[model samples]
Target chain A: MSDIDVAMARALLLARRGPSSDPNPRVGCVVLDDAGEVVGEGWHEGAGSPHAEVAALARAGTAAHGGTAVVTLEPCGHTGRTGPCTAALITAGVARVVFARPDANPDAAGGAQRLRAAGIHVSQIEDLGLRTEADALVARWQQAQDLGRPVVTWKFASTLDGRGAAADGTSQWITGAPARQDVHDLRADADTILVGTGTAWTDDPRLTVRDRRGADRPQQPRRAVMGLRGLRPGSVLERTGATVLDTRCPHEALRRLWALGSRHVWLEGGATLAAVFWQARLVDHVVAYVAPAFLGLGAPAVADLGIGSIDAIARLRLDDVTRLGDDLRLMLTPTPDPTEGA
Target chain B: MSDIDVAMARALLLARRGPSSDPNPRVGCVVLDDAGEVVGEGWHEGAGSPHAEVAALARAGTAAHGGTAVVTLEPCGHTGRTGPCTAALITAGVARVVFARPDANPDAAGGAQRLRAAGIHVSQIEDLGLRTEADALVARWQQAQDLGRPVVTWKFASTLDGRGAAADGTSQWITGAPARQDVHDLRADADTILVGTGTAWTDDPRLTVRDRRGADRPQQPRRAVMGLRGLRPGSVLERTGATVLDTRCPHEALRRLWALGSRHVWLEGGATLAAVFWQARLVDHVVAYVAPAFLGLGAPAVADLGIGSIDAIARLRLDDVTRLGDDLRLMLTPTPDPTEGA
Candidate 1:
């Protein structure tokens, strides 16, 4: 394979590290000898383990001399649980290094500079395809690091007209089965799932990640409920494992989750709770699964957001749109532009 | 080109006939001689014109003998303003015929059967690409013929959150200039543009078809207002020439327009008027231009449709989703399932 093909493969390997690699970016490495044959491959499997470059170098051993390393992310220069990858590569006598994405973390950045200082050839591949894949895999962690809070993704299921439930509150299945399955996949990517106390009492949902076969996923997001109201005893959420916080503030809940080393938080609350997050300007992303039906009455997907006029309304930037069965899923993010203040 | 390629070319020619061919399907034909060289090409330019096959046969003249005809639609077997195209093709001694789509109109079908019985080589291309193109070009007129009423396309511009205006009713430019330009394109395709009397009094809009250059288009849909209330004498829609119906009934207004040979109606009324048509089951199509901005406290795109509960909500089938500048344009149609009751 060419350098880009090998980098993309390394990106796939990095992604295999899964959501367990929170608070740290997933990294993958492949060592190639003089003949461009892959001699060893390794990924940063979990926290407090050997760095991907160090693991790859150990496997390559003598083959690492006068060889090139292709990595999904730029090698880290900072020493954490393991030694810095840059020092290990130089110690292994690596000749060249090619990476798909630059490590955005300030402490881990300077690997290219250190390698070049040691007279090693270091190249950053501007391949958009592989770089995009690697960037998306690390976006939540990067956002958490940049914003100093857990990146919150607010998810809701609504009718095509934006109604979340009927006047009588009968919203058993707004979207079909395929869209619900997609939500489970989304849950698997987050480290925490949160709902309001009203939802915990009304729906009594056990927010565990489950696959299509109804089996528990290997990694499940920690279930959390936020609100002053206490949960009913022996409720599904209370019976099944959920962290009940006695606070109504969205930021406080996020801070607590961040303290617990959560990088991503999926919020699946009702309209009133969504408005609270919107008012607090804590919602980073919005995922709305719009079913192909209309409820002229019932409830709006989001309650009045303290927006009495049009100019005060919060605007969301559209990221992606997909059709899942008869439903349309729209992924949006809070606009980065500060002029449109939340 | 192969037969399918030649048929696709004919479909493009048919589309070139444009929206002027309302009340009749646009069609194009190309005749190829035994040597496989194109002999003639023609398209149905207007409703009263000779059918595509007859026009092509006229152009081919004696060159049509022992030639194959490629048509966007099957040759018409029934007579209308002109003689049957199938009889003309057989009289012209065309040896073989290939068509992209079969004639679905009840009065116009049986052309393939007649050709086969007359010892002519008839082939249906079954090319979904070209057939879909031709079918969409005539869907409104075909639906009108089937339902015996003008096909109503209810169009409304809203914010991304589905608000039609601000709290103070300032809705001058909810969508960007590009989405408004697209609305004019939609208007140019319809035979009538209808609004409520309240909208006529409040907005005073000149519902004329205009191009991007701000010049009036060659053809304009007739402006119509449906409500019991009278329009202000000096209003734009009143002074600019609009038909003010005396009745508040949606069905009565549609009957009047259909009697005037209108095949498609573009409804751009306010919330109340839309609810009337929706509840009456008169709205067949919906075109929602969703702006990227939000207006939480303005007007909802649709009002109550007597849907007291979620189960009674009207469901729509998604047809198209498009981006116009920073806005989203969604084209949808009412679900055809009988259980939906609309």
Candidate 2:
């Protein structure tokens, strides 16, 4: 992207934050007048706010006439968080609409059609950075919805053979300090980090962002334990400023969370909880980091979520596969419902 | 494990490999007399190469009397590839044995039991490096075998949002150079790098180790393309020394390739190929590297593998997970069989 667009994208990114947007992409839109000053500015903050276009038009207040509305996502044609974004844009009298990404969710994927149908000038920059930032949380949320849960990513580090820690739990560092810190940064983007009480009890991990720079540390996504009876006084979570979602009944817990506000969640494993989430169909992504080391043998395999047939499947389509530092990371998303096959 | 066992455990780790040695661990066994001279060394290469114990005993020859053998994995009692390893060890007259990790596979999970039953000085060393390595790979493999396929890991690098490539397809460097090299190393461990012809034709990535210092660089692994048809002479495969496996029939093709000497393979991505492997129950493990980035609206997805019911299932118990520098990697294997759920 050009320097101007990059700055514009980041600014728009900062504007979009969603409470209901957990697992949903946080999007923002801005309309620049012919002279390049901001004519209208709006963002999708939390779930039920007026979408970017509506908010931008409302903020523009007659100044939107003949101005080009630069949007992060194609204006929505459906009434979701609010009314049709395309209609909003047209009613606001914007001369043209410049969008970085099209509405990706099928429900929202038709924004471009609606805008063009309304006879407004619609131009898609097809900028990648814009769309990527636009859909981070929402896309994963979409996958989770389509496939029945969140995208499950198993992140771990192992030796040449995949191992997390040595037997006896003396695993202080395997990949290196840098790699551990890398995880901290990752935790920042996650909506929540789901670890079993066992792991929290064993490691006493603070479960908060550390080993990074700037006050812009992780968003402090919610922290959770699998079982109902693991919260303790001396636990790592004792004073960590985070919410603990008890997921003994993960499906219901996730539903509660989704209803309240939770977009993505990370499963810190010990088998039982991983299985819980798996069975509950709550795990959205699986990030397994096989450290180039081993723990001889200790913890049990993440408990089985009782997946009987492939049909009771909590599906994840392998989206993109790559290698981390001496590790492999797999990206996953849910299979769409209709396409999930009857 | 105890501190005394850590050293021995590290030594045992040399044996483990990626998922697939189901019911059997990748093992390394060392035999020495009371004097502890390098009497013999053996690792589980795959099916039917002298089992580690037998190989070690055979190499020990007549000097096997009154010796202590340190093994990465516990010696077996039942026979799979050869006669019971415990029986062989006893017949060889070894006096004592030290194992870093106990055999978890049911067939050999009782190796320690058998060794103890034989009245030998058998010791289980805690904190064995071998344990961790074995756990990571075996968990997924066992899961896959039990569930009928390998694990699934998705690796993709985009924005924090989960975008893969830009709209215009200008994916020059989504990740840094080090990150790219890291991917090659991961591929090295893999038997194949499965991808669609679209990726092959577009970037013409060598898909081989360009960096020499990495392990995968020394001895390159196979590059197996999914849609291995319709190649132009000047295409990437034309110059790149890689194999093109037809995904039209994933199972049959894999079997054919196995017949053609493919011991392990890497499944590169292309939606069709991923879908085929996933649907056909051939994917044994999925190593996904997810970059904290996103690309909106590129390709629909990597796979639409025509999966119908969960009953067409190939499920995996979440095995090992970790974070790789600014990215997440998930190493997954299929769920293990009920009879031998490790």
Instruction: Please give me the total number of clashing residue pairs in predicted model 1.
Output: 0
TM-score of 2: 0.43
Candidate 2: list runs displaced more than 4 Å. Answer: A1-24, A35-42, A47-50, A54-62, A77-91, A104-120, A126-138, A145-149, A159-162, A211-218, A234-247, A279-284, A300-342, B1-342
Residue range with the least summed lDDT across 10 consecutive positions in model 1 chain A: A12-21
TM-score, B chain alone, candidates in order? 0.85, 0.68
- lDDT tens string, model 1, B1-342? 675477557645764665642666778888888787788887877667787788888988989899898887788776342237888888989899988778877788888888887889998776677777767767777889898899999998876556787777777777778999999988888889999998988888889999999898887778999888978989887787788887889999989988776889999988889888888989999998876555556677777777766666677888988988877888998875345545
What fraction of the true interface does each of the listed models get right, in terms of native contacts kept? 0.51, 0.00
Highest lDDT model number: 1
Show what share of the native A-B interface contacts model 2 retains: 0.00
Please, what is the TM-score per model? 0.80, 0.43
> Largest TM-score belongs to which candidate?
1
Q: Evaluate residue A244 in candidate 2 and report its C-alpha lDDT on the 0 to 100 scale.
A: 59
lDDT of model 2 at position A88: 82
Indicate the docking level reached by candidate 1: acceptable
DockQ of each: 0.40, 0.02
